[model samples]
Target: MSGGDARQISVRTKDRNSEERSEQLAPPLRRDQSDSITYRSFLRVRAYAVMTKPRVMELLLVTTVPTMILAHGGPPNLPLIVATLMGGAASSGSASAFNMYLDRDMDAQMRRTSGRPLVTGEVAPRSGLLFAWILAVSSTVWFWCLVNYLAAALSVCAILWYVVVYTILLKRRTEQNIVWGGIAGCFPVVIGWASATGTVSWPAVILFLVIFFWTPAHYWPLSVKYGEDYRRVGVPMLGAIHGIEHVAKRVIAYAVATATASLLLIPVAGMSWTYATVAVVGGAWFVGEGLRLQAAARRAEAAARPMRMFVVSNAYLALLFAAVAIDTLVKHRFS
Candidate 1:
């Protein structure tokens, strides 16, 4: 009754305690693993999406490729082009995300921009800004190391101008904000050209002008379409400040100016008949759109759709530059 009974009872007690502890721990371990997996997966997807930055990054990347082509005359710098595009993508992506953050208030007001992940609360403001900062800093360093000092510095300037000057200072201040802020976007081509040539030249300046003049032509029409929204937000766009009819005339004026500047490139940028033909045809058509916009001012939104030429303008520049680059390359290759 003594020793054997005590030993058997103690063993049973220890075994039961161990079984209880194991049962208690099992669900929690499984739950912990499941939660960890879910959180990690959400983070991973967010990282890839990077707060809806891929769109702006892609456009920035596209903006540089033509400069690379024209720089070497025919695609001599594939690696450099790739690096510059990536760096620019990062830099512009950061700027764009930061812009969304800064303009979150305005963005919330505008139906066009209200659906952003940050505004929609799918992602947090802090997280978006942090992603932007990473892209901006990383792209700056990348451009500095891979491209050149001037290119890196200019890239930084673009971001600073966009964030500080255009977004913070100019946007809410004056109706001419778009005009000045347009400078921020116009400089990317200059930076791209300098990254290749290692110096700013007349050609780069001309490309800059092309974008500069085209900026008003591009944005003013759209502004007319959204004048009411901008007025509600206190953003003094051309259409918001001046009458829509005035905005339309300015769009025409800017289009003509852009076309005239584009023609100068036939000699300066060393473009050929191919480029000239595109300039004439596309430019004439673009100008015609502006005129239509000016005339269609009396009509409603549907009537002016023909004059809303952003997509066409984009294609025009892309193809026009491409043709010039190809022609320049052919000439260089043959020579």
Candidate 2:
């Protein structure tokens, strides 16, 4: 061979060798293996999302924006609304994650909670704990930086109250646990008001009490449906310990209080007819459902359908808040 041809052959050999070595160092992944990895990652993400109890967060957020509108007396700053909502979501998610971690043991025993990430071993307890702390710290900082000091402080307090006071101290201790522990859930409206006004007011207090009274009315029926699950886990939920008739009476009382507190908003915030009609009509419907549950309890019917009241309570709160927002916008547009 000519000298040039031999050199070319040598370089070609070297290039082939280099390519072979690179393949050996990092073998190409099989398609199936790549698919398996992607599926696992998706499941991990879903598990994390479930740990946050997003359904509960949705209910908390339902009260927030309307309170902001009432406190602003109209549509507030768009950026401020977005920031407060994001911060509130993060704070709520952090608290829920912490609760899941702490209650994993109880969760494992309860059918309602058996599928939880920590209980099902979808997320390791230690990793879940770390995730909770990271979210708590990051969300508090997000509030401080993006929202305001009052919002930030309230967010921190909410996390502490939910994780420390509710989950750790109260949940397993008393039937009244939800009554007092529900205070954490009430914070969203107050935080919304604070975010809008930089302080809490009588209207905010009224809304806070509305949520407080509405909570038992909202939760007790679900507890009734799942009372056995709670009893199996040795949790002291009222529905698990008390007679259906007794639980129904309490639900009616709280429903009445919720309706009353909602009406107080009309005078305190000077809400218009739109809000007044919703509060009056929706409140009556809400209390009526409670009474219906009580009647079912009196009959000792096997299918008392307590869940009907639960469903109605959710719709009531959402519609009432929607009325609040709509009323404010109507007033703003005309005035």
Candidate 3:
């Protein structure tokens, strides 16, 4: 063999090595493709999660576990509590998704709700409705199996009341929408008590009233801030129909009623001193803020920032429920 034949063999060897390197690079490209697919899937799931109205679900769950503890007159079974919360979350999430689906037209008109999954087209309307239905059915089954039939039934009622009674029949037609519509938000207390003791009683009923009365106070100020949004969408929210003075006045009245109703829980539930004190103090603070809102309305102060009451109302309810759990735990430990 000559030098030329040797060089030809060297060139072929280099070509084979290059081919091997190309094959090695292919897996990284495939891995990148896999990663891209996973990220897209994550975004889709996150959009569905948003449709669940997680913030509202968190608040609903906040009221639930404490009621269970108080119902047991102590800390209840941990697993039962966890399972009940999971079912309740699914129920509430389904209701919220249904609301988003039903209200998508109005949601599209309002700046505040314009970014919701349905309104933004992140999830299709049909898909959202199906997701809600699936969750509604599964959550009912979950509660029946994990908690009790009564609790399961209550969960189902909450969904129906919210979707059918509140969203479809009442919202667009009545200024009293939130008044009656808000009842759906009160079911968790009864469900919590029923899950714990397998029945509803005076204590559960009293707590249910507490939340029922608190809803207007909790939600109206936010409505006050977004009155124009409601008006633009033809929603009859209290703030949309009434003047600021009337809305603020209603908030004050409801605040007082909410505080008064909370006190009933003391005698009825045998709630501890800590709960009584927090209820009285938190209720006073809430009512005071409401009074200030009304006074601002009287003064015609455009920049009164009614949203302040909206923020405090959330804190007030959270504090009251926290007091409920702490009081029960304290009594359990000391008594």
Q: Global lDDT for candidate 3?
A: 0.91
Per-structure clash totals for the candidates: 0, 0, 0
After superposition on all C-alphas, the RMSD of every candidate to the true structure, in Å, is 8.7, 8.9, 6.1
lDDT of 1 by residue, 1-335 (tens): 79999999999999999999999877664455536978868865675375546754544555567776777677756788888887887777878878888998888888777777777776678888888899889999999899999999999999999899999999999988888898888767888887888888887788788888888788877777787889899998887777656777888888888889889888887787878888899899988877777677667644766335766667776776776677777787888
Evaluated at residue 43, the lDDT of candidate 3 is: 74
User: What is the C-alpha lDDT profile of model 3 across 1-335, one tens digit per residue?
Assistant: 89999999999999999999999977654455436878878878998999999998977778999999999989998999999999999999999999999999889989999998898888999999999999999999999999999999999999999999999999999988888999999999999999999999998998899899899888888888898999999898997778778888899999999999999989887887899999999999999999998888888858566889889899999999999999999999999
- Predicted structure 3: clash tally: 0
Candidate 2 lDDT, tens digit per residue, 1-335? 99999999999999999999998999676677436878889999999999888998996679999999989989998999998898888899999999999999888988889999998898999999998988899889998888789989999999998999999999998998999999999999999999999999999999889999999889988898899999998888998998778888999999999999999988888988999999999999999998898898888757578889889999999999999999998999999
- Quote the positional error of residue 273 for candidate 1 in Å: 1.2
Q: Candidate 2: lDDT of 109?
A: 89
Q: Distance from true position, residue 231, model 3, in Å?
A: 0.9
Ten contiguous residues with the weakest lDDT in model 3: 26-35
